[model samples]
Target chain A: MARKRPEPVQIVKQRRDAALNGLVHGVPYVQFLGIEFDRRGDELTAVMPFDEKLIGNPMLPALHGGAIAGFLETTAVIGLAWSNLWEEIESGRFDTDELALGHLPRLPKTIDFSVDYLRSGLPRDSYARARVNRSGRRYASVHVEAWQDQRGKLFAQATGHFLMPASKDD
Target chain B: MNPEKLKMAEQFISAVPHCKTLNMKLTNIGDGTAEMSLPYDLRIVGDPETGVVHGGAVSSLMDTCCGAAAMSHPSSPAGTATIDLRIDYMRAATPGQTIVTRAECYHITRSVAFVRAVAMDDDVDRPVATATGAFTVEGK
Candidate 1:
């Protein structure tokens, strides 16, 4: 008789809630950017509510660019963490609870990021989504799209590159 | 157009509460270029260990310069959102020196504007960081 194949593990479904909590509480800059996580699963979504403190131009009455960048970067990192990439990479040796609670992992530092300004992001109510492009080990890319209140408006888009550490080192 | 730009400048300065806290003031604006200065303040000190401006503050200043450049465009009335900004830090800004940012708009199309800027102390040749950015135009 042929050996029975093991059941496929549902990685994302198992880890979703813990990951979202880590993101909300671990990152200090996330709160500073005033970005709130609304949903997390395969793709993570965040909302950037308008605040005068985050404005770059009071003249334009718009959200500041740095604040937007911070929002996108944070969203990308949280999405990856939620996907259980860190846990999978560190599998078996450590407790899942320890990994989730002890220290939230840092995103591999960004090597480069390119953003295309598509439309004005205004009126304080805006949303963005980040998706990770994973090919193999040691390299990952994140693409983000931000939308203005008018459903049709594509306010901004960004592609960021991060260099992952070697698996054995992790 | 010139008057509108100046009016925008005044409004931009007055609206930013943190800029006021940091003593950042808009000094000049014209011809798709703008200048702003942040006076030395104890609050700006980045590291209690080093007494240099924090990387976060430097990044904010660079972002502001690029955004202001985008806002000064002739067709920009509604405003612009930063799509992306990249900054290369060269050195720590010297203590007790006002950091000045000079930013210029390179091009603008229907949706996006490209900008380049340099932040320096009194000496223009030695810059603290150079930055490039893209901003999206908001609808009027």
Candidate 2:
């Protein structure tokens, strides 16, 4: 007699989905912004569907600068959510039910956000990614970049600090 | 006073998608400053536990206000875009309270306009957030 078990990769993917689904569905702002999530292996990306309501200027038809920053910050939260779920899994504390609640305790609180607009964000679909620069017990800092067409020609970039739960991973 | 110009700024801002989504409105524009208001809504809550308005909403309010202020500025006034912005959340806005933002285009150079803003709910003295930003100044 033999028993089948899920592979580590499968588990990670499942957790990522749980976190992403929880975030996209549970968070009111994220849903209000019409943001979606995608995971390529270990990297997390956020995609905001082009909606005219997001435009800041009617003539330029460009996205609101704050919307761009909001996408970056929300992406950072998504990145942190996945990482937090991963950490919980490692510590044998991961819970599927908790994901349904979309509780804020599991999410990071933004302390500050600084954004740089490199180019005008045209009225089109936009993408964003967050790179965790440093993570500590009390806080996590992330560097975020957003682009419309080419990653090199970033429309906007941001750096933010969030108050996160105490992590034992150091 | 350029009442016609301020009307244009308000109209332009009213068309912004995010502004519409947030129900943001241009309240006033004068000299170097512009003001906007965001009425309370449950859809903008950041945390259900705290029920505070999302910081993103506040950020959008400031960005829109700053852009309007830059355009409304008597000097170097024209179309403008955000160059950079830094915001510090002093505290969360009280739930069920409208958030008001006042931004001033304090300085202007050949290509950039410098602006600062404060966001508050009921207490003008106790601001919920403060922001400093630089914006692109296009041809008048």
Candidate 3:
């Protein structure tokens, strides 16, 4: 009798999910904002559910600009980390089980973040995605766009440069 | 800042849900300038290893401060919204010290207002972050 191994895709997905779960949960601020991620392959979509506490202008009844900026920054960080974790997992350098057991990796530090507000953020659930412009050993640049209700219309966007965590060998 | 503007600024911050959530307080308001403070809170901590506040939190503080400054500007129309904001992180904020941000609406055109701000913890000499922002100045 031979034991059937899980498919390659399933194994990859499980590892990816584990990595994302750990990365997202590692940051206390991420948890504080109640941000969540939805992953497809290597891409990620960050979701911030609407809450009354997130409103910035009660008169206009809009989401706070600061809240939107924070969400965009969080998305960029998670996206960058996921890309690196995917590679590390494939190379067998990352231990998903240990991560699941509570060991977390150090997060990258933000050198700068710039946000452009295109429209007022509506008082509803918001979504964001990050695109990595550059990823190197020491530095990374990521761009993020946020929208609500409609994907074609963006309410806010940001570009952030981060100081990547030093690799263990270095 | 006049008494009317001062009262308006206070009421403005109080109406903001995010401000109340973070316990941000307006310390001072001058002509086209405002100072705000954010108390050290464990929930806003970013790095568990260092217990430092997140850059996002700092950015939030700066953004709100900038907006407040813009609103208080004499040239500012009825209201304002952030157009763009760029923040450069200089250092990590101390764990227990309150973060203070001071913003100035340096320039105002027919349609936009420009602002610059700095955030600091206990060490006022070395800033934690600096920000430059543009805000909408509608209905000149």
Candidate 4:
């Protein structure tokens, strides 16, 4: 049987709301990244406002690459947490905080992630988005892109692989 | 030379439940600088096919280096949190190679400290990634 996918625009709206409502907890750093969930569904877009704290090179005044990577990883997690599958994981019926820790069971843990620097992220507000290439019982794959908001410059790109935990009760 | 700075760095990393698995070690410290290394392990691979180190692990290492560098400053003793970090991936590291990072404190102001670091497999020229960061010195 084919699974129904939520509209991209609708998913964006839901994620934005969840972010605003603090559906994802213990993330005081989210505001530091300047990332806001703007839209959601099959694809998710995040907006990061410029902040001096994120500068990597004072000489070039460019956004740091570590900050860019953090933004990308956080975006991917946010998208997954907003997906329909999260409901089942979060339901108290599981009775395990570890299970409710926002990690999807049946997925391989994110053993590794890599980001390639195509260009310097300018010292200005920027945007990032991610698309799920594949989601399975054992792993989920995602591709992400980040761009400067002013000139729309491409700053960095990343691919993430997350291991999904198998359903214990099943 | 204050032991508090190194102790703080050790405490912060140890506090992180996830980082406990990395078993990071603080090997050396000096003026405006600090060094730490993560022992190579199979679990740290980002690409098992290529044996490339995971970016997140690299970032965590970079973050710790910067944080320790900030703590080296005399004015701040309470410790600092990673305000932000930017890393550039240069290439994949060789498999089973201990990754060493050397972070230097460039500037320390009233509330923020600027840091830069390089992660190398064994050769400095052939760096796996380069990073710059800002850390917030807490407790004014």
- Which candidate number maximizes DockQ? 3
Measured against the true chain A, the candidates' chain A TM-scores are 0.76, 0.85, 0.91, 0.68
Q: How far off is residue A64 in model 4, in Å?
A: 17
lDDT of 2 by residue, A34-146 (tens): 99988776678899999887888778768888888888888887787677666665444766577676553357878899999988889889999988888777888899889
DockQ of each: 0.25, 0.75, 0.83, 0.06
Off by over 4 Å in 4: A1-41, A44-71, A74-170, B1-12
For residues A1-170, could you state the per-residue lDDT of candidate 1 as single tens digits? 99966534566445554556655555544555567887633556788787767665565566655556666666665665555454553343334475465365544445555556565456577788878877346667778888877656778777776666456566
Total clashing residue pairs per candidate?
A: 1, 2, 0, 22
True contacts kept of 1: 0.26
Error of 1 at B85 (Å): 4.5
Best by TM-score: 3
Per-residue lDDT for B23-113 in model 1, tens only?
6777777766878887776555533334565444555666777777787877776566677777656677787788989889889888988
RMSD (Cα, Å) for all candidates, in order, is 6.4, 3.0, 2.6, 12.2
Q: At residue A10, what lDDT does model 3 achieve?
A: 75
Q: What's the i-RMS for candidate 2 in angstroms?
A: 1.1
- In candidate 4, what are the lDDT values of residues A14-133, reduced to their tens digit? 444543335333243454455676643334577778876665445556665556776777666566544534454233232234434533232234534556666667767778777778
Q: In model 2, what is the error at residue A54, expressed in angstroms?
A: 0.7
Comparing 1 with 4 on DockQ, the higher-scoring candidate is: 1
Candidate achieving higher TM-score, 1 or 2:
2
